[model samples]
Target: MTTELQFFMSESKKKIEAKLPELIDSLLAPESLKKSMIYSLEAGGKRIRPVLLLSVLKGFNQPVEKGLEMACAIEMIHTYSLIHDDLPAMDDDDVRRGKPTNHKVFGEAQAILAGDALLTYSYQLVSTISEEPSKVVSLMTELSRAAGAEGMVGGQVSDMEGENKDLSVEELEQIHHHKTGDLMVVSLVAGAILAGASERDQANLRHFGRELGLLFQIKDDILDIEGDAETIGKPVGSDAGNNKGTYPSILGMDGAKQRLEHHLALALSSLKEVDMDQSLLIELTKYVAYRNH
Candidate 1:
């Protein structure tokens, strides 16, 4: 990662950490489910999704506080998905973000329940936020579409089924477009919509988000091949080990790097058109392709 991107990630990490407790308490339950949920959510991550959402909010000239709940809700959903994705029946990962998988720590049953609770509670958290009711409703709809059968979940299904098959580039693109790109698109668009952004700006931001999302996933694939386990906080070759289709698998390392650069350029160009302080987003876009972890 570039020094600038490292600074952005470090600053964003501190912000997420500061709010972690309140976010957990806000979504808390009386049962052990709460404990499990907090355990996994607090396990540590880049908090990239929430930071992205908040960046868009800032870009659109909205008060960052106004998007706080939305940011937290998206993070909750993302964390929940990660927990479930690491289960023995799914990716079967034993460690995540440099710690034991939720199922490994909480047991498979409670881990499942914790993920369920976080997913369900996300909607509740968004609903209670003080945004326009119509906007909130629209945000809820967008999030549902991103996380449901047509998006992340569908991508997961395709990924699982594609493991043993020789997936073409088009097929692999379809999966990443949904699995990784969809929620990212939602993050920018939702922030724009909530900030009362012009329709034209929203379209531009969505384009930026799509390119950014694809770049992010391609970098992840590269990291799987070349990153350190300690730096990436997971098994470095898990993608190959699991027979997962990836950009490098189809494009080769040089080709994948070229594609990442291309996407980053397009993403930066899109953001350049907007009248906003894009320092963080620009750094993040570059970092997505350059990060070691």
Candidate 2:
């Protein structure tokens, strides 16, 4: 990565990481519950959603401060989704970010409650953002749509239902567009909202985020087969073990790689329409395509 990109990522990640625990601590919930939420929040990863939101703000030359709270709120929702996603009933993942899954440490009931807490608390955080009421309402609506039945929850249901079935490429993309792409769409669009960006910019970012989200899931499918378990912080090849449909499974390895290239091109092209300093956003998009874990 370029030094500037590295620096931007580091700074953004640091800010969000600090805010997560602080937000968790601010809750008046039980100590154990707070600990459970903080545990998964602190579990290491790229913090990609918040970082992407911040990058969009930077691209608009807006004060990164305005995006920080919204960025952290979106991340809280993302973390909650991960905690639930790793439960025995979901992906049943035993490991995440090299640590034992939240349920494994907190028991399934507490983990579920922690996830619920984070999901609900996100709105409260967004409500507290000092922006105008209309902007806050817009963000709240976006969060609900992205994280609720219309977005991640819906995608997850499609994913579970499609397991062990012969799914076409378009069907797979449809599943991922809701399951993985929607929240990311909100991230970029929410950044635009905070930056007071124009309608054209918002539309461009919405498209960019969608393409990038699929690019993310496709890389994930590739990594599940080719990535090292230790490096990826989980067992490799679990998708196949679970009989889940994947880009490589449906498209073939070579075809999946070609598809990856196609989306990368489209994602970059979307950014070309944006009139701003996209140096950081462009590098961040490249990192998503090329990251090892």
Candidate 3:
């Protein structure tokens, strides 16, 4: 990665890490439930969604702090999803970010409640944005649509049904688009909206987000095949073991790599459609496309 990109990512991660605990502490919930929520929140990962939001703000010359609340909100929703995904009814995994999954550490019921809390709390955080009430509402609406049944939840349902079945590339793409791509696209859209970006710029950023989401998932599929348990923080071949439809499964390894490149190119091209300082975003796209974990 470029030194500038690395510096930006480090700053983003630091901001997220510093702010998340305070957000959780402000929630007036039972201590156990709060701990459960914080456990997964603190379980470290790349913090990509929040960083993506802040990156868009930075690209537009907006104050990163102005978007920090919404950024943390995105991370909460993401961590919540991970907790629920690890439950017995979903992926049923026992590891995440090199530690036991939420369900494993907090029990199934508490873990479920933790996910619920975080999901709801995210909306609360968004509502706290006072700079622009209308923009806040727009962010909330976009988040609801993106994270709701019409988006991520819908994609998840499609994924569950596609398991053990031979799914075509189109079908797999559909699943990933909704399940994994919606939130990602919305993260960028939320930042653009908060920054008062032009409609044309917002549209371009949304397109870039969509392609970047696909690129992120495709790289994940590749990592699942080629990465180790130690580096990836989860077992390799879990997708194959679960009979989940993925790019590598449907397109073969080389074909998956080609598809990854295709999305990467589309993502970069979409960035060019908007007139902004895209250097950070361009480098972040490369980071996502090539990350090992």
- Taking every candidate in turn, the Cα RMSD to the unseen true structure, in Å, is 1.9, 1.1, 1.1
Task: Report the alpha-carbon TM-score of model 2 versus the true structure.
Answer: 0.97
Lowest-scoring 10 consecutive residues by lDDT in candidate 3? 233-242
Whole-model Cα lDDT per candidate? 0.82, 0.90, 0.91
Question: On a 0 to 1 TM-score scale, where does candidate 1 land against the true structure?
Answer: 0.93
By summed lDDT, the worst window of 10 consecutive residues in model 1 runs over 20-29
Q: How many residue pairs clash in each candidate?
A: 0, 0, 0
lDDT of 1: 0.82
For candidate 1, lDDT tens digit of each residue in 108-198? 9999998998898889888887877888898899899998899888988988888878888778878988888888888888788788887
The parts of candidate 2 lying over 4 Å away from their true place are none
Report how far residue 101 has shifted in candidate 2, in Å. 1.4
What TM-score does model 3 achieve against the real structure? Answer: 0.97
Q: Could you tell me the lDDT of residue 121 within candidate 1? A: 82
Judge candidate 2 at residue 104 and give its lDDT.
97
